[model samples]
Each structure stands twice: as structure tokens, then as C-alpha cells.
Target: MSTNARQQLQHHLRNARYEVLPLRGTLEQVQGLPPGTTVTVTSSPSKGTEATLDLAARLRGSGMHVVPHLAARLVRDSAHLDELLSRIEALGLTEVFVIAGDADNPAGRFTDALSLLRGMEEIGNRPHRVGITGYPEPHSFISDQMTIQATDEKARYADYIVSQICYDPNTIASWVKTMRARGVTLPVYIGAPGSIDPSKLLRISMKIGLGQSMRFLRKQHGVVGKLLTRYTPENLFDELSPYLVNPDYNIAGCHLFTFNEIAKTRQWAMETADRLQEVPA
Candidate 1:
């Protein structure tokens, strides 16, 4: 890539977040990030939001700008939402990512991200910035039309979008175009799978019902091959550079789903950051 393009891409990388599962050793691995790098904690259905909050607080105390996923379905009511916000506030956290969560059943009144965002606004608990989810590939359960409409509505309340895992750069570019055409113009943080065991990634994608995306990955290898047994975002980032450098797209950065494989992922991030710095503007 040209130096200008590489530099532009680096600009986005500077603000990207290293997304991780709120599991053992999360804090230690996240310490690898340079100061000012954001760390996003995922909300696990098995562990609930408590783990996310705990990790977020720890990271914040350690000087990282932390963003914890506030799973709307896990929250019980308005009071619960208030308390969560209060705790986040006490820690001086000003950003959050809201999601509908993985729960098959809603825990209370808020069924989706938009509902929770509205609830926060109603209770005067709006964080400085809020993020919402987006899907570049068609959602397995929701219609494309519905996804578009819901995304359009959510854009009103959200400051940015962190897309669901997507491997196909063309598909992502097209989806960004679609979002722009439909006026869902929130700053977009492209979601890419972190360097991970391909088998584990396949299982997680399948469990989340991202069968269509999985099929796309399979087709790239020509049939159901083991070529996806190990994966990296390097190629995806190369494929996405055009859009990433294009100012009109308002593409903010990447949100890496590290799957808690932080050591390897941190190495990759550091190497890439070094390259970004070496390139002349």
C-alpha cells in the first residue's frame, strides 16, 4: 500500500479496541495494550454482566478506556439500569456498548438495545458515548429489511456501530454502502475476528447462528476444508484498507474479537502498530 493509505489506516488503528471475553487473565493480557487503547469487555450469558463490570472497573483503574457491553436482556428493570449506570459513573467510565444480549429470554422490560438506550436516556444516565451492534452479513434470525430498519432506528441513539464478525471485505464494503444509503450514518467500527484458532472460531460462529458467514468462509477455501483452522485479520484489513482510508465512509476503526487469546493477539497488534508507525505519512 502507498504510504498515505497506510498512514490513513493507522489513524483508525490508533483508536481501535481489543475486544476480549471477561474471563481469567483478561486484565493481564489487556495490559499489553498501549495507554489510550480502548478495551471492550464482552457480556457472557453464562457469567452475566457482573464479570464485565468487574473487568471494566479493573481496566479503568489501570488507566485503559474501558467499554463494557451492557446486555439489555440481562438487566431486570429501570432501577437495575440506574444502578449499573451509577456504578459505571463512579468509576468515571463515559462509554458503553449496548446489545440485545445472547439470552433466549428477556430478563425484564428491555428486550433490545434500542429499548435500553431509551431507558438510559429517560433515566438521565446516558453515557458520554454509546455503541450499538450492526451486522454486515444478513442476520440468521432476522430479515435483512428488519435489520436495516432496526439499525436505522438505533442510529438515532447510538454514537457508533461495532459490526458483528464479518470475513468478506466486499460484503462489508457493500453493507457500509447500504447503511450510508439508508442514512444509518453512525461512525462504524468494523468488527474482525482476532487471531484465533479457526476451529474454535467456527464453533463460536456456528453457536451464534452465523451459518451464512461460516458458509462464506467455507466457500473461500473451496468446499468445507480445514483452511480455516487458523485465521488472522491481516488479509481482512488489507481488503478493507480502501474503505478504511476513505474519509467519506466515516469508518472509525476496528473492534477485534480476540476470544481471550490475548497474548498472540497482542503480539499481532504490536507488530501492526509498529508497521503503522514506520510508514511515512
Candidate 2:
């Protein structure tokens, strides 16, 4: 590996953010993370937005920088949005990730992230930094053209973009180049799975619209076999290393979808950083 690639990988591993789901043991798992670590909390249709905000507040109290997900379909209306905003302000959080959510039915007026972002703007107490999701592969429901156009519109309000977890580095790199070509200047955070079980990863990935990427993985002989034991983003990092230091990619490190496997993921990250540092320039 080139020296600059190694250094860039090390830098990303050291500063990567963790994405955790709201569950029974999630808080305890996150508490073990190093102080000042940035943790993004996910909002789901089942848990609702309240669960995300509550956990975010607690995580903030624990000295971690928390970015809560504000799912558009979960919010009832302007009043609910105001309440959530009030709690976030009270917690002094300045960052949030917005998603359209996987809810089957609309909760209220806000049906998508763009609308919720506009609502936040109208409400007048928006977080300083807002993040929106990007899809490198085709969404399970939405078409590729629609996803790209939606991202372009949301870019006006978002500070950054966290791509959906993708298994292929070439697809991701191409997506970044496409976005840049289209004049979307937002810094891109490549999303990849952390150290996680293959079974669980597949189930979750299929659940969240990563079908195309999953198909790609299946086509690669022995990839599934290796993942059957354990899955890590090592290959992903190595494959994307060339773009990490390239200015055109505008890569802003990584967003690890830990799937609440915090300890394993953190250990892998630390070890990887050490291994990269030991490499000769």
C-alpha cells in the first residue's frame, strides 16, 4: 500500500463515527466507547423518535458527541417536530441525521427527509449540522434517478452525506465521482459495516434496501463463505484507499454501521489503525 493511503486509512479509523441502533443493550455498549467519540443514534418505526432523542441525550451526558436520527415519517406534525427540537436544544446537540424512515404509512405531513428539513428550517431552531443519506446502489423501492435527484435537493439543507452501507468500493467511488460531477460539494462519509456476524448483517442489509450490494457480494465466490464466519470492512478500506487521499472524492472518513457490535468494531478499528501505522512508508 502507498504511504499516503496508509496514513489516510489510519486517520479515518482513528476518527470514524459509530452508528448504533436503539435497543436494550445499546446504551451500555455505547457507554464503553471512548470519551468524545461521535455516535449516531438510529430512529425506527417501532422505537419512534422519542427513543432516539432519549438515548441521544443520555449519550451526550456520558460525554459522547451524539447525532440523533430524526425520521420524517415518525414525526406527527409541526408540534411534534417542535417538541423534538426542544429536547435536542435542551440537550445542546447541534448535529442530527435525517431519514425518510421505513414506516409503512405516513405519520403526518412530513413524508420525506427533504420536507422534514424544510420543516426544521421553518421552525427556526435547526441543528447546526445536518446529515442526509445517500445511496450508491439502487434503493429497494426508489429508482436510481429519483434517489439521485432527491439527494441533490436535500443537499441544499444538509451539511454532509452518509452513504448507505455498500459492499463494493468501485461502486461507491463511482457514486462519489458522479455526485461531484453533478456539483454536489458536500463532504461524503462512506458507510460500511463494522465487525459483525454475516447472518445478522445480511438480514439487516436486506431489511434496509441493500439488495443490489448483497447480490454483488453473493456473486463474488468465497466472499459469502468468508462472511459466514465473520465480516469486516478491511477489504473495503483497502480497496478504497486510493480515493481516500484524493481531493476529488471529498471523502470525510467513515461511518461504521456497527449494528450494536460496539466492542468488536472498536477493537477492530484500533487494531487496524495500529497495523497501518506499523507499515513502512
The top-ranked prediction according to lDDT is 2
lDDT tens readout by residue for model 1, 100-161: 99899989999988899899989998899999999988888889898888899888988999
> Any idea what lDDT model 1 has?
0.84
* Residue runs of model 2 more than 4 Å from their true location after superposition: 222-230
Full-model lDDT for every candidate: 0.84, 0.90
TM-score of 2: 0.96
- Which residue window of length 10 is worst by lDDT in model 2? 221-230
What's the residue-level lDDT of 254 in candidate 2? Answer: 89
- True-structure RMSD, every candidate: 1.9, 1.4
Error in Å for residue 201 of model 2: 0.9
User: Ten consecutive residues with minimal summed lDDT in candidate 1?
Assistant: 222-231
